[model samples]
Target: MLLPMSIQAKSYGWGFKKNTNHQPPDVGVYKNILDDLGGYYLDNSGDKVVYLTFDNGYEEGYTGKVLDVLKEKKVPATFFVTGHYVEDQEQLVKRMVNEGHIVGNHSYHHPDFTKLSKAKMKEELESLEEAVAKITDQKEMQYVRPPRGTFNKQSIQWANELGYTHVFWSLAFVDWNTDSQKGWKKAYQQVMDQIHPGAVILLHTVSKDNAEALAYMIDDLRKQGYSFRSLDDLVMKDILPEPIIGF
Candidate 1:
């Protein structure tokens, strides 16, 4: 039988023994590895907005279809990709860039930033920064989401010093497990049920269930008066338009 969630976290390196509150990563200060990484913090005050993001650790087997849905919907998004996956899925990454989506680094080995040594973390991030540069002209890949939402004050300081804005999820669904029976159904319900204004929904692109549910999820959210937006559209100060809907 499966162990409890808390126990599972221990086995999977998701516990808070590595964090101040046993919470997901948050920003503070990090060692400097680069000078252009961007970071984000809570900015939307009294507004109902949501930012959708995905971590491409490997592949969800449905990323292509997910991209197609986003492309068809003409909605922009941020795709956090790892170096190994980027190398393996070069064509898809190219398509993402060519199709006008934002691709950020998800580290090379998907290590928990807090668990890695400062130097190792720097290398992990820098390696991908270089690899992305090799594929695209966007030299300033400033955004990073630590693997498994693990971060700490020191790691955040280090990442910030390197110019990266560590992103964490406001909402996430269990779309990573292929063995789950109700993966897509549970994902759909979880996303729709908990969605709030300015939430950042985290989806894994390595799940076929997530892929199958992507378009429907977008449509459902749209029907509920939410519009899909890219992380860039939501955060970047100068690029965003005046607020259309807010609470």
Candidate 2:
């Protein structure tokens, strides 16, 4: 059976317009797709709250600093980590959990789940879950962010069957490129200009630019009357009930 045309696999590109009074049309479209599939991209609660998330595929000498900023600011955020990150950065992962932050599963090897069979996909998720559990003392892993922001109906369904909620970001920029660091000023402008209520913001833990601007970003966002939220507090309460398969 095929997914509904609205929920079919498509490369998720995070984008939005600046100085808008209403939710961007594209955001609404993506939100509906995730809503139908029991997933989430944006919070859309009309509150001045934003959910912060970081993708930690591997350590790049900046996660510690990022965590430091988060701790200093006392803002809760989620870290979606891979097997390599968990194995190599056990201390960092420990700190994340110890400091009241959520550690989410980003798969074992960071493969595009859309290209894998159901069993392979399960292994990818389960292996990472097992690693996180071992490190966090078997804390239940519930959130899954598809590597490279890619997914499909089958993969999402398989994840939900295993009691995982898929998370995609609603706001991200070209900060992943290490060679082309956009400087802290550009990073600050991009994030602050696009700030919106109930937005799921994605930042790479490896970006030095993000590290430099994180504290300032938090302060500026707060100045603008925005607050930070944890994904557990945001998505879990908003998830829709599982839809019947083969509709």
lDDT (tens digit, per residue) of candidate 1 on 1-247: 3334452233122221122231333322321221233445323433445566888877646889989988887767788999888899988888888887788878998877766767898899999988877887666677788887665555666777777777666566566776773756766766767666556677788777777777777877777676666666655543556654321
lDDT tens digits, residue span 79-188, model 2: 99999999999999989999989998899999988778779988998998888878775478889999887776667777898899998877788888888887888888
Q: Name the 10 consecutive residues with the lowest summed lDDT in model 1.
A: 11-20
RMSD in Å for all candidates: 8.7, 5.9
**Candidate 2 backbone overlaps, count:** 0
Model 1 scores a C-alpha lDDT of 0.68
Among these predictions, the greatest TM-score belongs to 2
TM-score of each: 0.77, 0.87
Give lDDT: candidate 2, residue 200: 82
Q: After superposition, how far is residue 85 of candidate 1 from its true place, in Å?
A: 0.3
Q: Which stretches of model 1 miss by more than 4 angstroms? A: 1-43, 181-183, 237-247
Instruction: Give per-residue lDDT, candidate 1, residue 156.
Output: 61
